[model samples]
Target chain A: MLYLEWVSFLGLLGCGLWIFLKLPIEASQGFPQKIMYLHVPSVITTYLAFFVVFIFSIAYLWKRELVFDQIAKASAEVGLVFCALVLLTGAIWGKPTWGTYWVWDARLTTTLLLFLIFMGYFLLRMSVNDRDKEARLASVLGIIGFLDIPIIHKSVEWWRTLHQPSTLFKVESGQASPSISPELYYPLVASIIVMLVFYIYLLLLRYQTEKRTDRLNQLLADTQD
Target chain B: MKTRTKFVIGGAIIFAVLTALSVQGLQEMTVFFYTPQEVLASPGKFENKTIRIGALVQKGSVEWNAQAIQLSFNITEDGKKFIPVYYAGVKPDLFREGQGVVVEGKMQGPRFEAHQLLVKHSEEYTVETENKKNKEDYYKSIQAQ
Candidate 1:
């Protein structure tokens, strides 16, 4: 786990160097376009983290297990942070390229909606006291919240948007070819892979803390009894 | 009982906020901007109504007044039909001829009065060999500034 953290961190640093020092300036956006390295990967990671939550939440609901719920909660917390990262990096990129930091366009708005939904997921977790009740309700909300990802992902295509459509996910005649040139595309893929590694490391670390806290709470409750 | 009330209130608030935001988002998502064809076809409908028009900046139709700090350009979805827009703001960094833009304002008697101008970029990324020459000129423009 420790090595995983270091590897992701160094991998990101290497990607940053590659973006700035080696990559050619984009034809239209030039220098500020480099922020895509940060923005796109965070977007991908946020999607993946919540996806983890969605899967485990379903698992918890079906199996009625604390471990599944623990995993769901852990991923949701990490996903929330990554979702925030997505918003922040998006705003930073938007200002330089789109001439504004924020817009109420569908793609941007739905992404914000995802962030708020998960924030409420945490708040919902805190509002309930009974462990089973909390897990049950939170899992339901987790599943509902994850459905928004597909909507967010397709917003650019489904409606009018100031934000551009997916660069990497662009399908050409049923083939998976990204819209980016080869020189820039490879590093973007590298960053997304590194970001996923970092996400795994964080999820494991947070899951440990969640498990310990649950055990400590049980111990305290027994002592009080 | 106390936690129940707290939970109800918190949940209600979250639901309310989410509903309100999505309603707004739905509006924007549905029609972030209308096309020139739509706006131009029913000129009376968009007139005096504050709305957005998204289209490409018509080639050779941009006029920027440095002293007045005003920009005027024609936007067109097709080659034949064009809508003239007047914007009283500094040109956006990405603003260029043939670039896509969304202008927010109302339609005047003849021209569109725009208060905000946003450049819409494309998803495709490409590197051109001739861009090298443009990059040098771009650097010169920045250094000169």
Candidate 2:
């Protein structure tokens, strides 16, 4: 699973870099500003993966299915990791462009909050002993907590904030502007597809690991009985 | 009207409220930038509005008043354009002339008043990641042979 996951992730990463490098020099902003593609897409994908967790959480609550719970937990775990990457990359980009790696503005603050919520979600899961009860609690929290993701995403615009306005996928342009020439856009889209493939592949591996752990736990209980 | 249905409806309401809050947040996340040339050409577009200006420090424009701990410099996107900036704050360690920089503040009167100035530096420090460093060292040894 590790090797397989790496292959898919690396391939996607390679494709993304290729597309990013191919962008015309005359595009909106020049070379150094290119980090936007990497940082923005990771943030977008983090939300997407966590939204999957929210849906699985709902399914787990409704049907009490262990499979749904597994999916929810796995997705949240991966989402948190991706969210961390978003912060790290954003900070890296921020330092050069914004002059500081951090600001307590709307976008940054809300992203930090979302990071904390996901951290709390994992901590809550660990503190529980009963498998079924843990799933029920986590499912409820996962479904509720994911509400913050979209809020963090849009906080910059809703308030008077010190963040940049959305440029990619703007209503004014059906696609990325000439600012993001096909050179960059193609790689960006490629990176996203690669990320999705890698994410799903990881989710399945983690779900299987959880199932095996549960089976081992059941075996121990039976032995005691 | 089962107990479970009520609980589900209550959960959905909570979800709706939180989603609305998040949507509002997502709308305001990015910061806009403008080069000195852009700001100068359409000062009207950016008039009285908070903005960031990017430029190189003009050759003879820097004036640091030690008493006030303020640093002043003229910036221009290109040599042909220039804007005077007055910043009264502790400058970043790497602040110097002929360097690229971004200043966040607003234009006031004839000067671009800066509330905050962050200096950018290239990454020269290396992280000691064991595997990466080790591999590079190994290749170097092979080349030496």
Candidate 3:
């Protein structure tokens, strides 16, 4: 845990310096293109965090393990933060380049839906009083909510959207090469790696807190009895 | 009815309405804009209806009326078929010739009058060595454009 914390902070610092100072201004969008490092990394991290939630939710259902549920809950909290970051950063980036902050296009709308579904995930978790019942219901919702990610990802191609298609994941000639130039692409790759490390650190910290909170609640219930 | 049953019924009603509204909205916005060729292909079909057309801003066809606060440009797909567009709005920062744009408005006779103009940035990225290395050069480049 200590090592992850150190690595992520230092990694992020290095990437930040490399991005702002070392990188050249992109041709079309000028300085505003710098937001891509922050925006894209958070987008990838959000996808990964929810993917963790999806996995653990399935594991909890299969094994009926409270630890699985706790892990899923921790990852969901982290995912929600990153998801909000995606929306915020995208909006800030959009104002200059796209000429609008928000559009009701499929990509933007489906992402908003993902955020809302998870908001309801927490609400549903809280509204149910029984611990086991809460886990069961939330796991189901988590599974259902994850189904939106694929649709959100494909919406740009499936529908006409103002948001540009994937730059990093662009596939041409059966090879996976980013449309971004090498000078800018390398730093973006570095930022994404550092962001994932940061995500792992957050997940571990949140999981510890969730575990302790459950233990404390159990202790209080025993004392009251 | 029992309290639990009433609560269930209320929840069901709310869910149904929310689902209906979203489905309707989703259907409407699924196709955000039509290509220039599609509009040209069927002009009478889209005559007065408010629609959005996505195309590249034609080169050297832009005329900005600063005092009147109107921007007029021709949008084209293959450099052959063109539709002249008149917009009354602030010019977006990225608005320039040869860039992709999506305009929302109605077709007025042979010309299109747009209310909203959005720039569609390409996925490709490049670093212009002479144009974008420093702050002054960047400003000069944009000014040159």
List, in order, the clash count of every candidate structure: 0, 19, 0
Stretches of candidate 3 above 4 Å error? B1-24, B129-145
Runs in model 1 deviating more than 4 A are: B1-25, B129-145
Candidate 1, clashing residue pairs? none
Native-referenced DockQ of model 1: 0.36
lDDT, candidate 2, residue A59?
Answer: 97
Candidate order (lDDT):
3, 1, 2
Worst 10 residues of 2 chain A by lDDT: A23-32
Best by DockQ: 3
lDDT of 3 by residue, A1-225 (tens): 999999999999999999889998998899999999999999999999999999999999889999999999999999999999999999999999999899887889999999999999999999998888799778878877887899889877777777777889987779997877899999999999999999999999999999999999899999999
Q: Write the per-residue lDDT of candidate 2 for residues A11-102, one digit (tens) a residue.
A: 77687557555554422123545676567678877988789989999999889999899888988988899899999888887765556888
TM-score of chain A of each: 0.98, 0.88, 0.99
lDDT of 1 by residue, A1-225 (tens): 899989988988998888888998888888888888888989988899999999999999789999999999999999999899889988988987888999998888889989998998999999999888999889979987998999999877777788877889987679987878899899999999999999999999999999999999899999999
Model 3 agreement with the true structure over B35-101: per-residue lDDT tens digits: 7778999998999999988778877999998899999999876678899999999889889887778
- Which ranges of candidate 2 are over 4 A from the true structure? A1-10, A16-31, A173-179, B1-85, B88-115, B118-145
Evaluated at residue A121, the lDDT of candidate 2 is: 88
What is the lDDT, from 0 to 100, of the residue A126 in candidate 2?
93
